[model samples]
Target: MISVEEAKRLILENTHVLDPVEVNLEESLGLVLAEDITSPLDLPAFTNSAMDGYALRSYDTEGAHEGFPAFLRIMGIIKAGDTANYELKNGEAIKVMTGAPVPPGADAVVMVEHTEVQEETLVVKKEIKPGENIRYKGEEIRRGDVALLKGTVITPASIGFLTELNVKRVRVYRKPKISLVVTGEELLAPDEEPKPGKIRDTNSVTLKFALSREPTEVISVDRVRDRKSAIEEKVERALRESDVVVVTGGVSTGDYDYVREVLESLGVRSIFWKVLQKPGGPLFFGRKDLTTVFGLPGNPASTLVCFYEYVLPSIRIMLGKNNKFPVEVDALVSEEIRKKADNKTHFLRGYIQGDGKHLHVKLAGPQGSHMLRSFALSNCLIVVPPDVTYLAPGSPVKVHLLPEVFL
Candidate 1:
């Protein structure tokens, strides 16, 4: 078995960052930027009112408070999206609606609720400072400044900013094409009635859901029987057409483990066979051309673990992402953890419980790699090194978060 560091080196060998592709702004959300985006025009475009109030020159509000109100002449009212038509002279104010451009010579605003208005006169109770309640031009984004940099994952707020800059499209790294293959002589299609000794295929469904979370286009999924020739053909096809090939089962040293031989024959040189990890100890990885090959264990939990710890990052690197590791959180162990001490790695299914600040983790039911039901109930993966003999309750442990938009 190889150490985790070695495994990472093997994965990154022969890999290069993906190039950028032009895409419409609508399709660029959640995608990584490949180039810097500088704003061509000032954000807010021009000075505008931030609230419904009166626009006044900075000096007019001196000593204008509850006791000393600065009375001034009322100019015209300006609503949102309207250009400037009224101007503010000394000791004069104009009613300005939110988002309306501040008229020339105006440097401050006092909310209407703070002032009493007569037919053509204005009464201000509280003092207002210059630039108060005003959104100055270029306040949000300055022209020729980098609004967003390369390697940034675009979010909704980013899209809104880009739209404000009149950016209709952007350059984003293209999604990697991934090929999935499941091999077993006893496996049958999910919808097919299984004959004696045959089981419905589950690996494909697992890979589909896992890969769907990434920016990838699943080239195709092939379910082949445990035949060496067929496996070779499929692996070769993956090497030729896909950026990454993920195969479930046939990584262990069992008699039916033909994937290793097939991959080697198809020029997918093995980086290492077994990894020093639980649930996914049987994982293997390889590389050929620009395509990465992951030999995932057949067990559901193990497959998912290998995918997240390794394959997921491989995809991100191939997509030109600068950072790929998922966010890790610290949580107190809610129960005693039993394990043998060593240098190996261990991953246990767990669920996190906490109120925002401190997250506590309790192991989810079982830790068996082959059990599928336990995974459905798991919300996190409690990581334990082989050297940890006993993790007492309340001990701090790192937990890899799960996709729990529902949790």
Candidate 2:
């Protein structure tokens, strides 16, 4: 009967990060970085125009004022990709488009709209300052400097930046191959209508959906009976094929709870049997060679709690992350709530709200293990510790945030 904190500490201390592997930049999203990355060249590589305007030396417009117009000759034109071959001399300007490289000896630019292109001559309506519209080279990134550090998850914005740096291939942590298994005689899949004696076997499928939020590749899902030998065979097969194996049910003390027995039979080293947490209590963990096994509770809420708290962290490690995990916080209760205290901790579903100041929370739906509807609608968990009395309004309570969505 270890506390949830104790169980989490033990789990983290026992697990090890997986090895790294290189992958292409196209497939790097949501995958962790195996190592740091540095820019091979300057981000822009050369100086370019920030606007479509005339490129001229600042001295040309020194005496020009708003009332007194300055006139100069338009000698050449430069488009985005074209380099201004003719450098700007005094009283001379070049027509430059957006992103065109600024020619040497030019210190300022007057917008084309502000300048009248009178045949070969250009007239400026107002005076401009030195380096007014010039975009300096390497303004975004310098050459030989690290653009992105190692272990930075590549996001959409990061993809754009990396692409601009001409990085076609990326070195990222390899996604783990995972196997989800469910063992129960009374279980049926969601696609099939449940018979009188059979309930839906949602643990494996739902767990797969949860784990698939990242870049993990699910090898396959296997359904086995509660028999120790049957579960053992499937477990062994999955362990050989996957980097991690997730099993649902048969982890408790019931006569049918035989997953631990099967893991032991397969020569797995058991980490622990239970933790002090509601919804999920009988979480069985073990290590078999390099593959890890997690036996989650059968109930939907229990399975979800296990996935969020334990399984996600384990998957993160498999994906090669050191500190990437779910965020937790202490929220103020909106109303007083109480329940019969047990030896284990209690996790109640809830909703969070902010009123321009501190965040307040209210119960989401119900606190039943089989109540999938409530869990689905929930956005957070009100974590109640053992020996705690009723939670009053404004009472600070710990909470684990969920992805926000309310129907």
Candidate 3:
């Protein structure tokens, strides 16, 4: 077994980032840009009015006061989206709406609130300065300007920015295709009737929901019986087709275990086979060419923990992301916990409280490897290093905050 840090290093070192591909801007949400995107045209494209008011020369509004107002002939109305061909002559004003292009020869805008409308004329009661209430062309972005740099994750706001620039497509790292293979003979589907020794298949469903937040496409999900031939056939097909294959169960040393053996037969190089961690010591990682494979423990909680700690980071690296780990926060334990001396590190499901000075966390429920109820109530994993044996109340601990997915 290796340390968690060593396992992560090996997984990342063995990964190969997917090649860049052009995708429609509308379908590029949650994808990282592979190339620097420069603006094709200037933002705002033209000088337009920022407010609904009258466009006129600054000299026309000068010396205009509340008591003594200046009157100017109204040339015409310039609504939004209308081309302004009329020019503002001296002592003349054009009624312009928001986002409407300012008429030629107009250098300022007077708010309608400060002026009254007369018959075929506008009564200016306030003095306005030049360049007031006008959004200039190329003010925000110039043509050919680098609007978004490479490795920038496309978010909702990023989509809006790209839309404003009229960007049609972008080059981004393609999402990895994933195949989930659940290995076990006694496992039954959720819709099946309960059997004496058979349990429902929770790992596949849970993983599918958990992976919904990631930038991946689930190409196939299959359940293989606990037989060498069946495991080999399914896993071989997965390795041949998908970019990443995740197999749950049959990783530990058991009579029926065949995941590790089948992977070796398929020419996959084992980067690491196990980690020095509780609930998931049998986590396996291997690589075949550019394809990656993860052999996760069978238990529900163990499967979830291993996915977050090991498999998720590999997927992030495949997507060309900088940060490959879950968000870690400093927290305080709210209860005492004791463990026997072992070489494996412990991660307990916990619910965190408090928001200000310090975060207080308590165990969600039981910490057994097979327990899934505790994980359901947890929002984070309270980390305990391998050397530590006792944890008292108010002790400082590193918490891996679990992100909310499939919600």
Candidate 4:
């Protein structure tokens, strides 16, 4: 068996990044930018009004107050998206709406609330400073500036920013196409009624939803029996079609376990057989050319844990993400916990409490590999290294908090 770090290193070393593709700006969210994006033109493009009021020379409004108001003739109304052809003279003002281009010679804007309309003229009651309430051209982003760097993951805010810059398309790493092969004869679909020895195939459902958060496209989901021939056929088909193949079950040492054998028969080079981790000790990873394969344990909890720790990181790396692992935090143990002294690391399901500054963690019920109930309530994994066997109350341990949004 290999250590968790070694397993991760091997998986990443074999994983290859997908080729970049040009996609529409609207569909580029959650993808990594392959090319550095430079602004073609300045943001706002031109000096515009930041307020829906009068645009005039700042010197004209000096000493103007409610008691002694400065009166100026309103040249015309300039709404947003309209050009301001008339320039502001010494004692002239233009009723400009927000986002309207600032007229030439206008140094500031006076909000409508501070002025009162008196017969066809505007009375500005407050003193205005130079360049106040004005959005200057190129102030936010200058032309030729690097708006977004390469390898940056696009988010909703990024989409808005690019849209404002009139960016129609972006070059980004293509999302990996994945195929899920769930093997088990006793496994029943979620909607089926329970049988004497049958159980719901929760691993497939859980994995499907979990993979949805990452930059992956789940091309197909196939459930095959424990027979080696059945597993071999599905695995071969998935390897040919998808960039990544996730196989749940038949990895551990069981009578029906045949995933490892089937993978070897189908020419998938085994990178590692097992990892030194508690829940997913029997995890397996392999590769065939550009296609990657993960043989997760049969147990539901073990499968999910292995996916989060290993498979998720591989997908992230393929997408050119900067950080591929779960967020680790130093947390205080709320109670005593014990583990049998062994060389393998233990990742116990845990619940986090308190504010992030002073974090506390408690074990979620049983930490068995098949305990899905406990996994449901867990928001983090309490990491206990191989060297430690016992943890007293208040002990500082590293907690791998589940990310709110996966890349």
Inter-residue clash pairs, candidate 4: none
Candidate ranking under TM-score, highest first, comes to 4, 1, 3, 2
**Winner on TM-score (1 vs 2):** 1
Cα-lDDT of candidate 1 = 0.85
Model 3, residue 12: what's the lDDT?
73
Cα lDDT over the full model 4: 0.90
- 1-407, model 1: which lDDT tens digit per residue? 88766777777765667778999998877789999998999987999999999999868778888888888998788888888976668988889999999999999888889999878999999878878899999998889999999888888898988988999999999888899999888889999999999888888998898877766899989999889998888888888999889999998998989999989888887778899988888888888877778999988789988888888888888777766655578889989998876677888888888877788998888888878777888888888876777899999999888655234
Residue-wise C-alpha lDDT for candidate 3, range 259-329, written one tens digit per residue: 89989999988888889999899999988988999999999999999998888888888888887888888
**Cα-lDDT of candidate 3:** 0.90
lDDT of 4 at 88: 77
lDDT of 4 by residue, 1-407 (tens): 99988987897788877899999999888999999999998997999999899999989988988899888888889999898898678998999999999999899999999988887788899889999899999999999999999999999999999988999999999999999999999998889998999998898899999998886899999888899988898899999999999999999888889999899988999989988889899998989888999999989889988988999989998998988888898889999999988888999999988763688999999988888998888899899998899999999999988764221
Residues 164-249, candidate 2: write the lDDT tens digits: 88888887778888898888989877788999999988787778788777789999898888887888888889989988888988
Stretches > 4 Å off in candidate 2: 63-65, 111-127, 403-407
Candidate 1, which segments miss by more than 4 Å at Cα?
Answer: 193-195, 340-343, 355-357, 403-407
TM-score of each: 0.93, 0.92, 0.92, 0.94
Query: How many times do residue backbones clash in model 4?
Result: 0
